[model samples]
Target chain A: MESLVNPYVSVDCVLLGFDGEQLNALVVRQSGNNGEDVAGIYKLPGSLINLDENLDEAAQRVLKQFTGLSQVNMLQFKAFGGPDRLKNPEDSVWLVRFYNLNHHIDRIVTIGYTTLLRIDRKMRKLEGGYEAQWMPISELPRLAFDHSAIVDEALKAVRAKATLDVTLLFDLLPNKFTAAQLRNVMEVVLGITLDVKNFHKKLAQMPYVVPLEEKEDGVNHRAARYYKFKKLKNKHI
Target chain B: MESLVNPYVSVDCVLLGFDGEQLNALVVRQSGNNGEDVAGIYKLPGSLINLDENLDEAAQRVLKQFTGLSQVNMLQFKAFGGPDRLKNPEDSVWLVRFYNLNHHIDRIVTIGYTTLLRIDRKMRKLEGGYEAQWMPISELPRLAFDHSAIVDEALKAVRAKATLDVTLLFDLLPNKFTAAQLRNVMEVVLGITLDVKNFHKKLAQMPYVVPLEEKEDGVNHRAARYYKFKKLKNKHI
Candidate 1:
């Protein structure tokens, strides 16, 4: 059968989910390598896109196939097409074996996409004989292909977006979050340490961050007031 | 001879330049179609990448070949890979004739890139038998293929970056510009009008927008004070 996928182009998704603490990325174990050392290696959930699908559609299909999540907003951050992207022999071996390619493939240009998800909210199950897991960004294992660099670029893109759009933070936080939780989201996304007082002062200036009457119920420390991001009628700060 | 360029991947550059007033984009007339109407249609300066070249290298090569300008910073904004990007029949004809390909070409995934330039500073000469011209953004002609959409996306990316980095505005402005010129850059790039007093008040808060001792001369009316962007050791607001 003729291959339905494009041989020279692929999409790699950086599925970053916040676990209410640190940001984590979803990675899948590579399969069908005949028990080689590269068989169990982790890689970003991605593959060569089908000829009939749009790039975004291909990314969405990859995201769903690996994590069983649909309708998630994914941003195309960058395209990795270095001449030596497949310099690592292991990458070429795994690709040829896994894809069952009869012809030699020298290079594949992969587009990098990213999305933020709440870890507790989404139900994730590994599919297609592949094992998947969410590993914290700091402790990520060495990824296959140029995926480590892809992850770093994805993080930079997410941080750049966070600086402009405040609502991106709401995607990672719970429905009602304390000021500390908000600060945590900001710090983790932006990769910076913020003083509590200064952060609160900055947060107070944003009209979209509405304070709720409810407070934390069960906690060891004092119950902190909760805040919810209010949907503004106009452009957000 | 075997084709050196990758048929499946290409690069399109959106070279925007500020002419001390409105922002303009550098576009080139498509050639080599026996003087057909499609041959004269304008498109963003772009072409497919060589098998051995990186994406950035391909974009840089195209930029230099079209405009005779080199070493300008370009940012990869997005990838356009819709299955029907070549639904326009003219596009397929142009591609086949331009590349002299024997096989059927169904799709080409083109990475969109953008860069800001000062029109008065760079000596732009049309190269490679193509007539290149800078058309004001407000008066861009109907472009071939999906280039109109690509230009729009590039403008959006530049505006998004302008909000985060002040240095981006300086790229379009003269070294020493009046306050009105600065405001004009902000308005044109961000696509918004700013009140003179309010905008000046906001500019005052930015420490990097240093005021120069010299004022504008040879003006019909009272000259406005000149200001230059001071490179900060740290981040600029």
Candidate 2:
């Protein structure tokens, strides 16, 4: 199995997307010879990087192919590698010399990646005849490999950032939104609803939020004030 | 490199032990050669598990073999696998079916492990002439694959736990120790010296950390009050 490690390194991406009220996972039911060595499982959409491709390109390509949606953001998580973690052990897969192994199985090493994508609730119908559902983070089934734990870690990160990083709320907004609609997204992600009256007051104070002086339409009676986040490149902290 | 994704799965343990104030990586530098492959420098001891071996057993056996020590404390991080993380796609090292691409390279997946052991610091010499240094975690060099990142993540976990987990400070103390020594380890880990008057008052108050009758030696002009953490089974959380 020492002969099994290869000429390319691959990354697995666990994408998390959110709406106004729910925190969801972007999972695709796996296809191929479902009944072969591996069967009856929905795993992360992962693949090996091309010989000339950088890791980002490989991850983006795999995500697009599996989800049929493009332009989502992805970030790298920790890497995984160890002996006997492979499906087939009798080749060069053990060639992953970085992982120190003592057992007989050839070691497998992988760089885990994550993405926070805007959900195209409608385009999900274009997926490969496989059921793709936005399962709540807590109820994910026994995932293939250590993916369950992977989601656990990624969620911690999302929750942590929800408080400090304001950009995440963009996922929940439907292109044009009222301040009240935007506040709903923040409440869901924060796991606690803030004082709506005070929240509106704070939004009005931020210089970057430009009030359009337009009113939301199709309401039962009086429409609410609408605004857009003045687009500014985030100067990373 | 496509040939490198083995269906077989396994785990790897990256055991980190702390002695008093400094950090140590429990690694065994190995040497072997393939046709044109050069075994370059790397860190940590590792192994693969038998088909019937539980993840915990594999980690324990690997730890005993590498350190001649058993009943060590540890945690599993993640599993890794992506075909072609290695260079040479072939040449068998372990028993699993692995596809190695070239000399000194392979696609591998590994489950990471982190631990805190109070091994006799004098027994630091590697049995096989492999160097095992209790080097400061801050000075780790570029490891093979993404191992450097693995250790980095572990350190982050340790740092995150420093504030709340009482057991984390135990590794730095002897079987019995003074509350002052425990506080010192916390300061080193958090990278900021805490306010002593309140820190001492707080540790004594925690139900889990009972004050010991013992006090420090004459080495200190004023012997500090000693306290010990109540021992428990695997303080992983």
Candidate number of the best DockQ: 1
DockQ-based CAPRI category assigned to the predicted complex of candidate 2 = incorrect
Please write out the lDDT profile of model 2 over residues A142-194, one tens digit for every residue. 66555566677666656555565676556556666678777776776666777
TM-score of each: 0.88, 0.63
The lDDT values for all models are 0.81, 0.58
Runs of candidate 1 exceeding 4 Å displacement? A1-7, A33-37, A121-129, A197-206, A211-218, A223-226, A233-237, B1-7, B33-37, B121-124, B127-129, B197-206, B213-219, B223-225, B233-237
- Predicted structure with the largest TM-score when compared to the true one: 1
lDDT of 1 by residue, B1-237 (tens): 121122378899998988889899988887654544465689998988786788899888998887777877799999998888889887897877777666567888999999988888443444235667888999998898899999999999888888778676777878899888888889889988889988888889888898889998998999889998887653311
Sliding window of 10 residues with minimal summed lDDT for model 2 chain B: B89-98
Writing each residue's lDDT as its tens digit, candidate 2 over B113-139 gives: 667666464446543344555556766
Ten-residue stretch with the least lDDT total in model 2 chain A:
A92-101
lDDT of 1 by residue, A102-199 (tens): 66678899999998887774434343345678899999988988899999999999888887786776778788888998888889989888998788
lDDT of 1: 0.81
